[model samples]
Target: MPEETFVIAGASLAGAKAAETLREEGFAGRVLLVGDEIERPYERPPLSKGFLLDKEARDKAHVHEADWYDKHNVELRTGTSVASIDRAAHQVTLSTREPISYDRLLLATGASPRRLEVPGSKLQGIHYLRTMADSAALKQALAHGGRRVVVAGAGWIGLETAAAARSYGNEVTVIDPEPTPLHAAMGPELGGVFADLHREHGVILRLDDGVAGFWGAGQVSAVVTSGGAEVPADVVIVGIGVRPNTRLAEEAGLDVSDGVLVDQSLRTSDPDIFAAGDVANAYNPLLGRRIRVEHWANALNGGPAAARAMLGQDVVYDRIPYFFSDQYDLGMEMSGVAAPGEYDEVVYRGDRESREFIAFWLSGGRVVAGMNVNVWDVTGDVQALIRSDRPVDPARLADPKTPLAELA
Candidate 1:
């Protein structure tokens, strides 16, 4: 009998993790992991930190050692992209004109960095951090330091990249339309904490400004903002955001929203097809809504959950959405999803001024979201609080003496 075949698109963290789970779960199927990039499946978190700082090896970034794929009977296809999905025939057409059929298909296509469309964007020194190649190129340019580095966007990628560049001794300037960095995501009070952190590190914050265009003879020389002000720049990194790679899923006639729509089990409109990672706008039963998260933790956990669901296991991809960031001396872990205007109050424990605190967003006396900065070993507690959805006294919630477990 022919082996049951499983095809996974976009050999990313989610893809790799799924492949690993398939064998671990005794699937004994033919696994084909396809990717458009030339490298093997790898983790992307280190791209902005250790990899950029030259403290991480190229091999260290990979999800598995080189021999792992072959030993597990997984077919690895690098530098290949899916051209179309033939849902009717259960086959995928590749860019190379090859067609592969699958009993189960997983789309882990992920997302691409949103680009700036302004004039002079074609200039040579402009960069976007999305791939290993991008990280390597940016690291090479920032290695010498003393260069004028202008980072556009105050999102996680932008801020992390700025921290890496600054650590290399480069004079850095960060631009964003918000009055302060991370304002939209974390609110102004907590966002101010990050702004102050960057300022203390000697990084200039160009807040409440929009980029008009770029200025250069050939390579980028400066970034022109809305007020006709030009910030001299030898290199510019844009990290505005990312758009999920949902075209193939859309073409395949699956439900597509901000991302590919998946049920609570990560199953798409077609049961044989599933989506995970950044490309999946999966329903979270715990949150009572669908959310598309582009962070590492989602991919790490969602991959296995989706795989288990594919195997017909009784499971749901309901893990609390979480992500963490490291900038300079700051380490932060955030859990739970904050629906727009859902939280009525922000409760704080510890001292924000001292950069050691945990902030909780409470809605109807229940924790909706929690963030711990420069605080460790409490993410599990925060996760439990959000999961329990139990009411807690605001005073106790803000007291460092009150254990997070006790609040639940």
Candidate 2:
């Protein structure tokens, strides 16, 4: 009998945690984790929140200590990229022309920030927030304050970065084509709340307009909008969105849609191969549909589930979609999928005027998703309501006096 070799591509949060799980599950076989980044696996939330504000230390985002991999006998290959996977030969070829054989493989290649296609986009000072280096550079550019910071897109990334910019006393302006900030995520009902929140914090909002182009000599000095208005900017941050990285899996003859297609067990089209993290559009039993989550919690939990499945354990990846964001004095946690038009109405408990409340999205009188803003310790109860799939009285739900647990 020969010893098995397990290979994981993309040294991201998912890949790193998968390696840790394999060892903890007593897989003594050769474990190799390869990534293109020079830095070790790190969480991304801090890049837009705490770290960007310089409130969190630089070393706090790492998945494991600098020495954890070496001590655990895991082969940590940083600054190395997987160019292709030869499925026939059960091997992955590196960019450096190195080939490694693997009995089983995991692809957690994550996603990349989508860039603007407008003119002058190549100008200096136009930034995207995806990597640690990007956050560091943006922090340096805004930390001094008094700079004109123009952010394109009013999504979580854009708004959070805008808050950080304002925290430093910089003049911050956020532009988005949608009617309200977070329009796509929370819909118009709750999006209005965020719009007011940012405005109250001294962040300017330019809604219903899109960036048409940039103007500058060598670095960005201003942004021209579709509405024919020019907004001055010393630094420009683009946070539109991201696209999943599925080139490796796609080229390997695996099923690919918006992301790599996988079953409930995280198994790809090929049995010996699997995908997780932002790259895997996995079938979720709880949702009764396929969902590809780009949030940090998905990566944090998906990796371990995939590892257990690789060990021949019965695994069902049905975690409720979850994510969190912090801006200025507000902190929020959202659970379950609340895609546009999927939910009929949103019910609120607590005071919306004070910005302390739990908003529930219900369809057919059943709670599909819930978000708690400036409210703590109700995540489990919120999740339970979503998982129970029971219809509830809207009046009772709206009553703050009614405990969420009783409704569940």
Candidate 3:
């Protein structure tokens, strides 16, 4: 008797990782990976970074090159969408009416970029960086020198694209309602450092402002701020954030709160079904709350966790939840979670002035979360220990003379 088929919905990072993991764990099953995208599994982080820098790397975006899936005996289906699921019948209805039965299912549908709802948002030159098509369009709009680009958000995607635009010698302006860029993620002190950096790069920073919409007849040639300031723009990009692509799970009557809610084992309310990646609002043992991490690391780690759980290995899915972003030669790394200034003050390792620093959030005189700029490798042990709330010497944390790993 053959092993039961494992059907996966979505074929991007999380889905592809799950299929690979299943094979690696010696699961002799029929793996059916369904995805709506025609392209193979590719990295999204590179789409905003290296892919933007080097045009040739676009083809290299696929995580698994050509015959890797075949060698693994994984049936990868592209350009196909899963329309519905019959949980009782253990069958999935694809758009093509091809019903496939599965012994297990992994929901890694991820999230979609939220669009700007305005008059001229549908116009040309207004793009959102979510998929290859969006990136390709934005790349074309930003190709020429001296193009007036307006980015309508201070979030990761907007800032990243703004940095890329500035690198390519484009006249860039970033508008956001936040007082400083990354304030939500990095807090005030670090946000100010980021703000200063962007201003230093000659990026026109419009703080505490938002675009009412776009202008021009066919293309978004201008951005009208909330205060009625019309900033001229050759191209407009919106990167407010993404909403979880949880409609399929919700329609299938699966429990969903913000995202498809899953236990620590990455199993959904329905035991046969599992959810991972940006689509899974999982219970965080460290934070003691249900949180959905949108980082690439989550997609990678969570996929394997779900697969392990499905295979009856039963491993606890308590990943460190690390993420990194590089822009304008500055690298930012984060580990663990912060609980609303549970830290009295951020302890520093290096000078923040030079932008080569590690700041740790403290609560009850113990480190909770750590952020390092251009010093990610050193953050490993600190993250592992701090994420577990292991006691550390405050003196060692503040002392540049002391090695952080020593305290860990």
Candidate 4:
């Protein structure tokens, strides 16, 4: 077995960032980065946002280009997957049926889009946005616009795709069984605002509903609702959520909960193996709990931390939860962890109707979490207050007149 060689599975955000950090930290060990996608590490956030609108937007996510990867001495193996991991042998089996030795392993296999398993769900034009190919397919359908598009899910991906479809002048409709959209991520009170935003933009909105199945001979022609309502469509997009890709880990007998269970150090059940990104069920210090965060920030931040730990450097992933979404002309930035109905009240710092706002989840004058829209600059302050757990006047927080820095 080759000693001091580092191997990482899944070369998306987490895997690539981990490799970059490992080399930058002066670790001269041999590095191997494996990815299922046949492309170098590129940003995913733009796939659903900018790339849908501009073709050249692909350059936005080129993390380390081919030249850069070569200069960094990072061995990037794309279009390959870890079929199984042999912890005892310190080897990982590749999809090509090759076993490679590793002193340390980081499983960063991010996630795949959740699919509707119902009949006709396999029909053509029924798509899921998770990869560059997925985006390209949808983007081609968006060209010249005017196609009737039905989106079956009001999650971040679905909504953002709907926005992109609308921007291209496509007739887009969003359907979800939730009473309000994004209720799980953003609560009902805030999720309702999102429902309004879609409606105001002329996208047909369906709440408290779901798809029955697809209609057509080959390609999707229309969407049938759970309650027997029929909506005509030329394309269907489903973005319910993502499932952590852990089949290889599970088959290898690694401990798996909702995700790969990892300690504060990002190590898995087997000490030689580690996991991060959407695949890592990591311990959250601020929340004092084990949580799986499905965001670019967590994947980017936690990946390097896991790499440092593998390289014998003590590191802890303790950055506040950070994520954002762009839809319509509005941009949202939010941080912290506050559960629903746990807070006694919410404090608003900006106007709601103007499409700019920052609301805090407050309990007994202590800020626990926050929701911000078009106020990206203040997410840091909101994060500080939520983590500080210090007291503040509710009236001051609610009052837009008060200076935000005063609360900190």
Who wins the TM-score comparison? 2
Give TM-scores for every candidate, taking all chains together and pairing residue i with residue i: 0.98, 0.99, 0.96, 0.96
Error of 1 at 87 (Å): 0.5
Best by lDDT: 2
Which lDDT value does model 1 have at 72?
Answer: 96
Q: How many angstroms is residue 131 displaced in model 1 relative to the true structure, after the best TM-score fit? A: 0.6
- Which of 1 and 3 is the better model by TM-score? 1
lDDT of 4 by residue, 24-115 (tens): 89988889999989978877888889898764567677777778777888888899988888888999989999989999999999888888
Whole-model alpha-carbon lDDT for candidate 4:
0.86
Candidate 4 segments whose C-alpha is farther than 4 A from its true place = 1-3, 338-344
- Tens-digit lDDT track for model 1 on 259-313? 9999999999998999999999999999999999998988988888888988899
* Cα error of candidate 2 at position 214, Å: 0.3
Please report, in order, the local distance difference test score of every candidate based on alpha carbons.
Answer: 0.92, 0.94, 0.86, 0.86
Clashes of 3: 0
**lDDT tens digits by residue: candidate 2, 1-408:** 788999999999999999999999999999999999999999999999999999999899999999999999999999999999999999999988999999989999999999999999999999999999999999999999999999999999999999999999999999999998998787889998899999998989999999999999999999999999999999999999999999999899999999999999999999999999999999999999899999999999999899989889999999999999999999999998887887999999999999999999999999999999999999999999999999999999999899999999
Query: What are the per-residue Cα lDDT tens digits for candidate 3 across 86-187?
Result: 999999999889999989999999999988898788888888898887787777777775999999998889899998888888999999998888766666
lDDT score of model 3? Answer: 0.86
